[model samples]
Target chain A: MHEMGIAQQLVQIAIDSIPRDIENPKVEKLNLRIGRLASVVEHSLTFCFEIITKDTPLENARLDIDVVPVTVHCKSCDNGWEVTGPVFKCPFCEDGDVEMLTGREIEITSLELADELKI
Target chain B: MEINIQKKVLEANDTEADINRTFFKDQNVFVLNMMSSPGSGKTQILCKTLAKLMPHVRVGVIVGDICTTNDADRLKVTGAKVTQINTDQFGGDCHLAANLIIESAKQLGCEDLDLLIVENIGNLVCPAEFDIGEDARAVVLSVTEGEDKPLKYPLMFRVADVAILNKIDLLPYLDFDAKLVVDNMKQVHPHLPVFEFSAKTEEGLEPWLDWLKIKVFEKTGK
Candidate 1:
């Protein structure tokens, strides 16, 4: 699946971000923010990450994905609301002309490392 | 030390996609990324569409599949240059990436081409997630696939510039409601241009062909 490709990218990003001066740095956890509409299955991504990072520096890195809810802004009502499920119409005015405000991001927010670089 | 690395994991892919976009621009080639589930008649639609445009424009194709040159072989009959990317070599990726497109374009020879179409691997969910550096993304939805697909796969419908409701000729024999499907797609993306047609009967391809020809002309000024 394409999750493998995404997992490979995530693993590469984590490994590349490690400090060069730090010796034998280990990634502890990775904080990932994925929007609800990103179409990524978390378990599949985690499984792929685990398998792909086996021989790499991110072997021990635990992927923590935070799923953001889909949000839409109603132009007629000038209000925005988070969609709980497949409801796309504006909750207040029942407007179908609402614009999507969020829920499409797939990014890494931060990462935790075992050893801190000394100042 | 909590070194803040607020970077996107897929940044590398995005950067590669931008480079491909620039190349398409410089070459004056309009790239259309066609995405759909398996058996949605994407290849048939391309065959019919390319046959109509080949006399006017130079079209090249880069088709991706897990392990088949079947699509390429079929599309070759249209007299367009076709290159196949078997993802089986790359661990059977379900979707085409920008890097893969770049390599396949080189294989297909993008020079002197007015339009390039990347037929993405058949899938509704995974292919929607990747941006493969296309000037326009079109989602092909068949009548038999159910009208609720747009709701279930919101991301795919939302990101598409146009959607083709294929197999319009089958509507007479089946209980599928074209209006309901169009309404459902509107719920996801109210402004998404949808063209309802059947590639088999060539029932409603004029609007799609005209739109595409105009787009190619807009890009190449030819």
Candidate 2:
């Protein structure tokens, strides 16, 4: 599945961003903001992430996923509406030609590392 | 310390893709990244395309698939230089990345080629996100997949410069509305050129071939 590839990329990104001073920074959590239309299955991504990070520094990292819904702006009625389902039409004007404002993102928003001072 | 790194995760891959863009530019090669779902007749289109253009243009193909070289075998019948990249060994990658394309280019013998078509693994979503340093990305949609595919996979339709509605030969049997697909694609990408054709019967393939000719001439001036 493509989720495995994405998971591997996420893990690599986190590992690459670690500070050199920290010997082995234990990843506490990974914050991801994935949009609803990104075609990424959240459950599949989480499952793959766990398997990929088993022996790595992010062994016990928690995945914090925020699923963003598709928001569309209708040019006909000048109204914006959140698309809840697979259909991407404006609720106000019933326009199929509405512009998609969001819901195509797939990014690692932030990373939470264990505080070395507390350790 | 929580580091808020807003950097793109695929920056490394993008850098490599830039190298590929420069390489293609230097070679005066027009590369096209072809993407579609499984059994959408991508190889069939390539075969028909090569049959028409091989007499005048130098064409090469780098086929990406999960396992077999079945597509490559089909392309070989067209007498075009074809190379297959089995991505199954690398965990069944859904798309071919720029690094993989670069590696395939080496084995493809790029010096003797003018046009290189990369038939990406039969997946719509993931392949559209990855830029493989191609001049244009063409999305193939067969009539059997239903008319709502453009709306369902809008990102792929939006990213593509050209949309080929293939398998028109089967349109009479199916209740698929071709106009719906065209409308949906136009909604996502207002000016994307859509070519309706069947690679099997060679129906409505002339315009697509002509478009390819114009594209090659525009890029290489030959």
Candidate 3:
């Protein structure tokens, strides 16, 4: 699954983003912001995470995912709304010329680490 | 202590992709990433496209598959420099990542070519998720696949800048509504450019080739 590649990246980013001063850091939670348009299966990503993070700094890390919905802003009418279904027209002005505001993100917002460190 | 580090999960990939993009920009090579199902006639269409694009535009190809250089072999007939990346060695990746593209481009020598087309691994879902440093993304949907194919896998068409409906020569034999398929794709991506072609009969290729030429010119200014 491609999620395996993404999961590997997530774990790598988590480890890389962590401060080096945190001695013998133990990961407790991983906060992820995944948009609806990313097409990543949450369960599949979590499963891959479990395997890839086995011996890494992210081992046993609890994943907290926040799914972001597809939101669009109408360029012509200056209206914005969340897309509920396949329809992409602006709700207020019914304009089809719209720009996607969000919903394609796959970001790691934060990492929670245990306070009990070796230092 | 909880660390409030906000960063993109695929930042590493994005960085590599940006570097590749700059490399292409400096080299003046327009890269197209083509995605589709296993038997969607992607190689055949590329053969036809290369036949038309070559002699005027120097074209190169990097094809990704789970195993074998079969597609690369087929594309060799067009005389374009073809590089085959067998993902089986690397755990059989379903899509070509940016790092892989960078490696392949180095091998293919992108500096000498005007256009470098990446024939991605034949899968709709996986390839859509990864950006392989391509200037444009094209997804081939054959008539044999079904009109509702876009409905089932919206992300592929949603991300595609262009959608090519191949195998139109068999349209007279099959009970497929081409209009509905186009409509379905438009539903997902309102402004997405859709091209219909029959690689067997060589019909409806001019627009596609012209579009590619325009893209190449836009990138290379040559």
Candidate 4:
């Protein structure tokens, strides 16, 4: 339900973060780090990104996404594991008191540009 | 050749949520963000819950909708401060961000209240990804919906602190299996407590309130 709006945000944020001191900045790629636990579909985001970036500075920008997998730490046992599915329980200790380590990030890591560009 | 921005896509929203978290802590208010799909009986459950929760704890609610204050109007009669936020004016988004919640809560004077509940815009996907500076998150699933919803939307189930299996009253008339849903919910997040109850019948509502009371006390330390 939100790929379109989030893509719009991605486009705006990407364009705003570009260096303005250069003459005719041209963006080539937008790198994104998304968590597996995050509710974002890579295909949907790519589709939305292409549509919103049309005619904008990011029109030719390729979306490079890195899917971060879910990892958790068991507080009771001090055990950590890379979770493959939806289960968050501590497999070693059966403790439910677990904290997520890496699976909730939703951020723009960097931008590859041919030259300096304006959004 | 490249610029390292390392910025969050929802930086504005995250900053606002951080500000809201600080304000909620300063105000000593325990906040809960409740989410569900449309027609999950979220309002009906809230009405029943407020009726029982208001007498003991000072509660406030912010109801969000696409165009109307219908949910807020229903919640106001419980004597708890209630406010309605229509997302239509704010780009008509499918989710309620913290920037909107803090404004509505402050208008309700939530600083004086012991508990603040935000009935998030009825959505499973977008709302799950957005944090509204809440101490706890709850997801409501009715018997009318698919049992595999937890598997389909693992992010929502994974993020929720608790799950509510609503509409047990309709189980006899439908093919939905409550146990399977509970199992599916646990498969996604084993730690979350699931409450099975029918808001219409007022059955199984007490346990949820008890859980809420404990959460409020744990956070407010009162």
What TM value does the first chain of each candidate achieve? 0.89, 0.88, 0.89, 0.91
lDDT of 1 by residue, A21-114 (tens): 8787778899989988887788889898889888776787888888888888888889888887765766677645688887988888777887
Candidate 2 stretches with Cα past 4 Å from truth are A66-103, A117-119
- Say which prediction, candidate 1 or candidate 4, comes out ahead on TM-score: 1
Which model is ahead, 1 or 3, in terms of lDDT? 3
| All candidates: TM-score | 0.93, 0.88, 0.94, 0.91
Model 3 bad stretches (over 4 Å): A89-95, A117-119
lDDT of 3 by residue, B1-222 (tens): 778878887888788899999988888899999999889999999999999888799999999999999999999999899999999999999888899998999999988899999999999888987877789999999999989888778778878889999999999999999999998887777778999999888899999999999999998986
Clashing pairs in 4: A25-A116, A25-A117
Q: Kindly list the per-residue Cα lDDT of model 2 for residues B1-222, writing each as its tens digit.
A: 687866555667678889899988888889999999999999999999999999698999999999999999999999989999998788788889899998888788888787999999999889987888999999999999978888788879877889999999998899999999888877666667999999999999999988888888899886
Model 4 gets an lDDT of 0.88
For candidate 1, what is the TM-score?
A: 0.93
Candidate DockQ scores, in order: 0.62, 0.39, 0.67, 0.67
Among residues 3 or more apart in sequence or in different chains, the pairs in candidate 3 whose N, CA or C atoms overlap within 3 Å are none
Q: Is the docking of candidate 3 incorrect, acceptable, medium or high quality?
A: medium
TM-score of chain A of 2: 0.88
Please list the residue runs of candidate 1 whose C-alpha ends up more than 4 Å from where it truly belongs after superposition. A74-78, A87-98, A115-119
For candidate 3, the TM-score of chain A alone relative to the native chain A: 0.89
Best TM-score among the predictions, by candidate number: 3
